[model samples]
Target: MRAAGRAAPTSDPAADASDLRVIGRVAPHLWPPGDREARARVVAALAFLLLAKFATVATPVAFKYAVDGLNDAAADPRAVLLSLPVWLVLAYGAARLASVGFNQLRDAVFARVGQRALRSLALSTFRHVHALSLRYHLGRKTGGLSRIIERGVKGVDFLLRFLLFSIGPLALELAMVAVIFLVVFDLRYFAVIVLTIGLYVWFTFKVTEWRVKIREKMNAEDTDANQKAVDSLLNFETVKYFGAERREADRYDRAMAGYEAAAVRTATSLAGLNAGQALIITAGLVAVMAMAAQGVLQGRLTVGDFVMVNAYMIQITLPLNFLGTVYREIRQALVDMRAMFGLLDQPPEVRDAPGAAPLRVGAGAVRFEHVDFGYDADR
Candidate 1:
């Protein structure tokens, strides 16, 4: 236990170590040994994820072809009536639909796996809290402890969903888009894509790292406020007897005041982060579109190609837009999970001896032989 005056833990080498440890601990639950059904579900989910990403990457290509075919048909009225690019249009719509459908299927299939892991981890944490010695509980804050478990459980769910769905798929799609740019379009397009991605990722991570501190401050105040409220309410009769309602309200208000300040900082920092991200994304879009337009004017690429570049840029931007928020939440979740895992790391104060026989009573009788107990062993 930390002293009251001690500062809250920040992200450091030790915290990173704990975060890795938590991931390792939770991994087994997600992919439990001897659970064929869970394993099968995981495999199916991956299959769907791949299909979804492939469809997503192909959507822009299909659209490009549809546009090209329509442009050709427009050159001749007879061709316009005969060759309306129906097949290309259908393929474009189908690809878009398939992308969404497969993504939904992946989530539906993996829902069981995520929820199971959440339940298992939550139950383990609950039982471990109960098993800890009374001395430990007596010194703990119930409200804070409960909040840790609640946040940790929620963290597990978010990590499972986003780490697999958002992060992995984003990487896969980015790679595919890069390949398309390199193969079908000019190398310049690919270079721009790579540079933009690099800048966007680096900026998002740096800003999010700073925001994490503000988030931690907010969480600490929130936990403190909750603890004060719960503690006051639990001792309601004592407060009434002592006529200290005003004192209790003042204490709670102080905690809330800190929370309010921290909350405001979080919101303001988030706005700045969003603004910076938007600037980067917009700059990338403009640069790429300008190059594409130049290619069209120089007869190096068609109007359809310009539109395709725009489509792919929009596709990439959609995920990049949320990158900051997702990264921040994941970091905060790690912090929460680390706290919960700390409880699980504690060794029980009492345990049955190895291979100890169970007590059997024919006629129950209390027996005491030199038994002495004190809450503090030092006493």
Candidate 2:
């Protein structure tokens, strides 16, 4: 159920408020829910998530064991150089498969949780819009209003999946890896992993922050271009009578030119961000590998342990490569969803009294006093 004293959500996406505020506004509809089944599904989803993390963390270790067994076989004169340990190989494959299986199970379980939340929000928004005063409907564009709600609806699903699956699971896996290193290996190895991760994350945040502005520019220009084209085409007869087709085309081209420039910049900035993040991971891998090599040469670690280090780093770095992009999109999702969420902050133009009654066919005339709803007045 909703927390106490929160503003009621409206259908207007332009309602301005913080993400937490917006989420709180919709919280009642999604959680501490009246439906017991939904809560169960949420619990099941969390359980699956934990299972997935366990499997993911174990996968690298399994592969390491397989590699070590093969290394031993190679050194034995009685054995073939490429002879494989059947059980180790099977365990490694199982680890990989189990991780994927658990991940998919989590998604399947959580799908209902997300869908229910979206449905509730969408229905609430619909009812709120219908309850609004006629002036509110007259003042808003149907296309813009629809797009805002659509984005907001889809945004909830995206937010849930990204935060729960991508960010949460990856973090848990990282922690598990850190623990494994501390318990079974060296502190220096853990430090290398941690340092590389810290640098990679720092670099990603800095670059992604820069990209956020570029995205804003691109979105603004793209909207302007689309709006200009729509307005011009919709008023084609007026433009014909005024002999302004060429003028319309020029304005449209100018808007598109701005959009084109912004789009190009976005592509270029994304490439740079990817390259910088890759470099951070590469350096981290080299440092971790060096430590592993030193340990192996000193007989402090087995050949298998060295291979495990590489496997774990490779696995960790693979997901991290997309972390920046995922984070950026998550931020954008909040922004897109904010408009609808912000509606909660808007006070309605009309509301019934405590003892209000539904209007009847012969209801008395409506009356108002001391109201200043000028066309230009901010709502």
Candidate 3:
């Protein structure tokens, strides 16, 4: 499940999280793993995000002039037409450049981050698996733990990508919408848009929280059912000896039925989440469009200004939706992190004294003074 590597043994998850280790916890260890050149590449990529966002918002402004100039042919037909092509070309070129830059950065960041994460997880799991007492592995399912590490590392990658690139632009665009309104339209209109967005986000979180809990429960149950089936398969000889094929099938069917039921519930919750997001976005767009129209009629907002508002509205919604997705992923990543921390918390069975003298070379002698041993059935 994991590639070759060397990492310190895993600690108990709780202990890892709680330990006063000033270094490890403070640094999430998920940053891009490239050296100096890689760091430069990541910085360049971030610059691209800013450029992309600016280019994106700037396009509508260019169109506004194109529209106004085309409308005013009597003012100077040739001049207007000449400027139109230039503006269109610049806008298109800026957008295309931004697209190329953003993609390159995204791939570079994900690749670096993913490689580091997988390498770390592989080494950590390998070392930790050895550090743990034989009892721990005997009781735990190796396959399940392997899968968890694989998934947890991917989750961390997702978090880093979304947090680094998507989040900043999302916040900036929302602020831009408010700023544009305050500059060109009424404060009241900006307030309305801001308030609506806040409420929508609040509602989305509450609904998503409930759905996540339900999904987690469903996942746990599904895992249990899967484990049972795996056990049966591994013990096929015993099952055949008992002539319990039909019985095993029945049990498998029951597990599958429960899994399907949980899956349906999860699907339903996801559908509701999408619907809620759509409604919230539509309502916010309508409010902004209405305000823009009012501003235009009152002669406070120009046609270009209206176009800017529409662009801002789109910018706001796209990121808000993305923010919701990011938030959910972050929450999942945190949960995975907490589990990892919990694993790190498990104390080692053997530890050195706080301060001890170095051993001197001498003839070996075996000694077992008052040996004691016990085993817990539950454990």
Q: Which candidate is the best by lDDT?
A: 1
Write down the RMSD of all candidates, one decimal each: 4.4, 7.1, 7.4
- lDDT per residue for candidate 2 within 1-379, as digits (tens), equals 0001112122234533465665565556556557888888888889988987888888888888887787777667566434566577888889889888988988898787788788888887777877777787777655556666777788777778887689888888888888898888878878888898898877776676666666767666666676677767778799999999899999989988887887788777767777777788889899889888999999999888988888889888888877876777666667767787665445678988989888667757868989776674565
Each model's TM-score, in the order given?
0.93, 0.83, 0.77
lDDT of each: 0.84, 0.75, 0.65
- Judged by TM-score relative to the true structure, which candidate is superior, 1 or 2? 1
Sort by TM-score, best first. 1, 2, 3
Q: Any runs in candidate 2 off by more than 4 Å, and if so which?
A: 1-17, 25-29, 73-84, 230-245, 355-379
Candidate 1 residue spans exceeding 4 A from truth: 1-15, 77-84, 356-363, 377-379
Predicted structure 3, TM vs. truth: 0.77
Query: Residue by residue across 155-205, what tens digits does model 1's lDDT show?
Result: 888889887789889999999999899999878889999989998887777
**Residue-level error in angstroms, candidate 2, position 278:** 1.5
Best by TM-score: 1
Compared to the true structure, candidate 1 yields what TM-score?
0.93
How many steric overlaps are in each model, in order?
0, 6, 15
Q: Flag the better candidate by TM-score, 2 or 3.
A: 2
Shift of residue 146 alpha carbon in model 1, Å: 0.9
